[model samples]
Target: MIIELESVFNTEGLKLPFDYELDLSAIQVSGYSPIAQPVRVSGKVENKAGIVNLTGNAQVIYTAPCDRCATEVSKEYNFPLEHTLVVALESGENDAFLEVPNLRLDLDELVEEDVNLALPSKYLCNEECKGLCMSCGKNLNEDQCNCKAPVDPRFAALLDLLDE
Candidate 1:
């Protein structure tokens, strides 16, 4: 969705409201397409004392595999979107503002970027997730495996002394 911000840029105290669903099912994160539904973005672009600002929230529920055990996990994510809209900037190094060069802002791009940045790098099924047992490839969360922990070869002679 391209939002025309020319009117809001010119008039102080003017507000433009926007609400839309953006489909992001094709976006892959951490080797999985976690987004199961369209992201709901709703917010307003307003001019406050000659400064245009965009404020809104993006929400969605995504399901993906757990980082450790590969178990499917579903999570809801809500991201707050806030940015200063600028027609032009004196310096190009500022990332704090969104530039609307042609008086049009791409709402989908902004929301997608924000949501992607806010997502967690690792997803866990639970805080106490035991993950998978390395030797048997069994999920420890579901069942404990009979594999013993590997002993270091340097400590083998010391272990023999205990047996004697």
Candidate 2:
């Protein structure tokens, strides 16, 4: 969603309130496509002293895989976006509000950035997650595996050192 800044640039100390909804369902994560629900954004843009400041709140629903177990997880996320756009003034244009050339703001990119940044680095279905067994590829949380594992000979020196 590209908001036109022409009107804001024309008037000094102008404040415009707007509400918009955007669909951002095509964002990819972990080699899978996760559908991002429609996000509602409402904010005010104010032009003060040749600078445009935008402050808004965005609400989004995201569905993705759990980091630990690769299970699907769905949740709603809310992010607040605020930024300022500075307009470059031309020579001898003090009274005249300088026009911002091709001022376009991408709502999708902004939402994606916020959502990705907000996501936790590690996600598990439960806090006490007993991960899969390394030997037989069994889920340790559900059941234990009985496969005998061989010890690496290189660790013998370290084991002896610890005993000392």
RMSD in order of candidates = 6.2, 7.8
Estimate the TM-score for candidate 1. 0.86
TM-scores of the candidates in the order shown? 0.86, 0.63
Worst 10 residues of 2 by lDDT: 92-101
lDDT of 2 by residue, 1-164 (tens): 66777788778899878788876676666766555667787787788887787778877766766654555777676778776654666677653242445766565576567666766566666678665654466766677678665334367567878999
Local error of candidate 1 at residue 106 (angstroms):
0.9
For residues 27-98, what per-residue lDDT tens digits would candidate 1 score against the true structure? 798668899788989999999999999999998888998877989988888899999999887676488887
- Candidate 1 C-alpha RMSD relative to the actual structure: 6.2
Misplaced by over 4 Å in model 2 are 48-50, 89-100, 109-121, 126-128, 136-164
Q: What are the lDDT figures for the candidates, one per model?
A: 0.88, 0.67
